[model samples]
Target: MDLQAIRTFCRAVEAGNLTAAAKALHITKSVASRRCQSLEDGLGVKLLARNTKGVTPTDEGALFYERGIRILDDVEDAAQAVKHTSDNLVGTLRFTAPRSFADLKLGPPLMAFAQQHPGLKLEMNLTDERVDIIGGGFDLGLRIAPELSDTSLIARKICDIRHHVVASPAYLEAHGTPKTPEDLKDHNCVFYSNVEAAKQWRFGTGNNARAVRVTGQVTSNSGLMQLAAAVEGVAIATLPDFFLEDAVRDGKVIKLFEDVPRAPSYLYALYPERRLLPLKVRLFIDFMADWFAVPENHCEV
Candidate 1:
């Protein structure tokens, strides 16, 4: 069987139309049609069914397409492995990360990486919403959590992230600082809607630890929004060290409950599990781990 024909068939399945597949492959529609027909004939099966809306693979075609994708991935991995020796990284690296991290921490290191490999293209989607990395065709993801829920993806801890309950000096002065976690109920708190834990702030650790359901005038999915509100004396916010480092240093915000031990969290680099990891993904993970280890970039608790 012709690999090109198999590729064309796979593209058709992805594109959902012969013309679109042909355009993507830079081939004529007739050529695309012939390739699909040839692939079907060689296998002695009907591969696709066409309709006014578009086209869909038959059951047999769907099974074949899955295998075809794996075959193509293997071929690309083999090529990338050989190309690694030349120190030339090409093609696109698509990834997703939290918007707050993307804005504060990812810009510098990722830009430096892109500059080093002029041939590489970086596509990043920064949002608070959790994305389906594999379904979205993302090469890798950066996440901050105490523990990852998806066991299918391989996660490597890049660095430890510390969380703190902080408020602007003015806000604390007006609302009065809480001597303990229980005192938080009397004060208005800024909640991050995206995080489940944000609804209930956890303080201390082990037997002494406690969870408090706090109320706030402002609730937002964006950490930056919560940080801004906290800075303006709106309310107290439980935020990560990376987001509040500059503010705390500048005296814009004051970290509260100095003796309280917050739960442990870490910055994680997550990617789909495979027998042979792609060189680009592996290199990126290593670079980020090293970058975060630098003292200047470290977020000390």
Candidate 2:
């Protein structure tokens, strides 16, 4: 089988037309069409259906495309594996991560990686929204969650993250401190709307666990905004330790209910599952693990 023809067919399926695929592959449309025709003839199956809407993969073609993607990925991974023995690393790494984490924790180490490999280019999309890593053409993603989502991607644990209920000293002074979890109900609580239970904050551990229904002066999807509100003495906020570390260290924010316990979440590095992983992606993952292993690199509660 011709890998080039298979690649061209897959590209055409992804691009939704031969013309688009040709432009992307830097080949003429006639060449792309010829490759697809040759692929279908060799396989004895009509891979694509052409019409006024351009071209679309047939049912069998769609299935073939999926396998083709993995085949191509495996081929590239094999090439990268051989290249791994060299001292120099070169490639573009496109990844996505949460905005707050990127700003506070990820930026430094990733920048150092970029500096170390001058031939490498990094493109990072920092947002809280869950991105379609494969569809979006991202090489890797960093996610912080209590439980991993069911997906085809491979995930490796980076570190454990704990949430802290905090408020400015002035806010606590004026509104009074919450001595217990229940006391939060009486205070103005800033909430991260993106959280699963934005209004319901849980405390303690198994068997003794309890949930508190909280109402606040403000609610937003951004954790940074919630942290800002808490810092300005506007409302109490439950934020990850990484975001509250500097604030607590400077006395800008005070952690509440030191005795109360909150469920701990984890930071994970996610990437597509492949038989032979790329050296660049593997190197980054290793670097992140090492970076987080150093206590000073992460926030301590």
Candidate 3:
């Protein structure tokens, strides 16, 4: 019935005991027990069966528990919304992002956002492996490339990443420049082995994208590794611009077929499906969209 009492009840369920719940909620066990008791009494149902091992939610308790979770979420959302619209949007934004994107650039924008919104806090996780944001307890996520599997989460396309087929200047000179996608077949191509068809490189061919089957003397599942190989003139690599900025800038790799058509991977910001996402999540998504809106965001892989 009461928000605080329901919060206490859910806390007890998550913690498995009144004492632990109080510890988690920074309240006394007596207060925790009182809240849980009041919540159960108001609903006219036994919510928990306390035993020597721990507190377990009963069948009726389980039903109440689900509703209780939503109630707690609403309370948190309300508090965050209030603070968000206030002078400072103060709260922690738990974020996950692709590994390459994080190591290179995510920190600067997030740092700037935090500086502007002094009350905002960020907990960032960077990894190549796709994460389950809801299951992993993340507030939001950043992703690039073809949209992965669809879920209940809300995804916003932030930018388009136009990829490049580049090889080191030396490699181009040694192997000869590839004037077309067919030209790559003659050159030793380094590949991202993790891709479903590493041996089959796709390129724009009229109305339909055509696939080119090739042999690579060197290959690795890691995009970074492939970039390194391409930089050293081992072989030509096709990778997103984000991972090859330095190499491309220094003329280490030469972008080929600039006039030809190419595929573009999209960058996206994702959040849960809840109607009331926390202010932290909402603002973080806005900041990311703004940060990636620059002209140089062309990348593909």
Candidate 4:
């Protein structure tokens, strides 16, 4: 069996389309189609159901892919074990991350890493939604949360992310400032819709912790949009310290509850559970941890 054809089949399945798989593999769509066809012919089985929209794997294809991907991973691991070097990091390094966090904090370090490893191709997909890391064929993911619900993936805590409640001066002036955690319920608050129980905003930690059920005029999944609403005096927004830094510094918004400590969320590097993690992915995660360890990299609330 042709190894390249197997790889193409696997990539096509993950990508949900031949075009995307072809792009990732640095090959033409025609070539990708041909490879998959060759693999199917050799096996005497129809591996793919191709339509104008994309391609879907047949049951046989899925079964083959399940085993083939592991075989490929093991093969790569064996090769890396023999000759591990930065120069050998030749291939796409795909990952996903939250758009706001990646745009705000991950840019510099990611670019620096890319520059350091000229042979490696970095493919980063930024979205605020929780992505299927394994199904998406991503090598890793960056997530910010108090805790992840998905236990299937391996997680490494990279850093603590401080969250802050903030509002525009005008909003506070008109609606009256929330003097305590309880007071938040009396005022309109912006919500991050992506979070479960988004209306229940938590404050403090452990014994003194409070979950304030907040009413909101604006709710959005995007952190930037939430920040905007707060800046525009639509409502108070509790957002990551990084999201509030610029607005607070420019006096567009005022940070509230300075004395009350909010439960800190964490920045985590997540990857699918596998026998051997790719060396490039491991190194990148380490680089992220080292980068964020610097005091200057942290945003002040």
Best by TM-score: 2
Across 153-205, the per-residue lDDT of candidate 4 in tens digits comes to: 89999999999999999998999988987888788888898889898888888
Model 2 Cα shift for residue 136 (angstroms):
0.6
Compared with the true structure, what per-residue lDDT tens digits does model 3 show for residues 69-130? Answer: 78777888777656567358776677788877777766677788889888777778888767
| Candidate number with greatest lDDT | 4
Q: Write the per-residue lDDT of candidate 2 for residues 137-242, one digit (tens) a residue.
A: 5778999887777477899999988899999989988999888999988999988866688899888777888899999889898888988999999999989988
Question: What lDDT does candidate 1 reach at residue 6?
Answer: 88
Tell me how candidate 3 scores on lDDT. 0.76
lDDT of 1 at 94: 87
The list of candidate 3 runs beyond 4 A from truth reads 1-73, 193-195, 296-301
Q: Cα lDDT of model 2 overall?
A: 0.84
TM-score of each: 0.78, 0.81, 0.72, 0.79
Predicted candidate 1 versus true structure: per-residue lDDT over 1-301, tens digit per residue: 6888887888788667888778756789899999999999999999899888777999999999888878877887889877754368988888899988888888999998888787878989898788766545577899998779978689999999899989998998887888988888899998878776677887777788788878879998888888999999999988888888789889999998878856768999998766567888888898899999998988664
Model 1 TM-score on a 0 to 1 scale:
0.78
What's the true lDDT of residue 199 in model 1? 73
To one decimal, what is the Cα RMSD in angstroms of model 3 from the true structure?
6.4
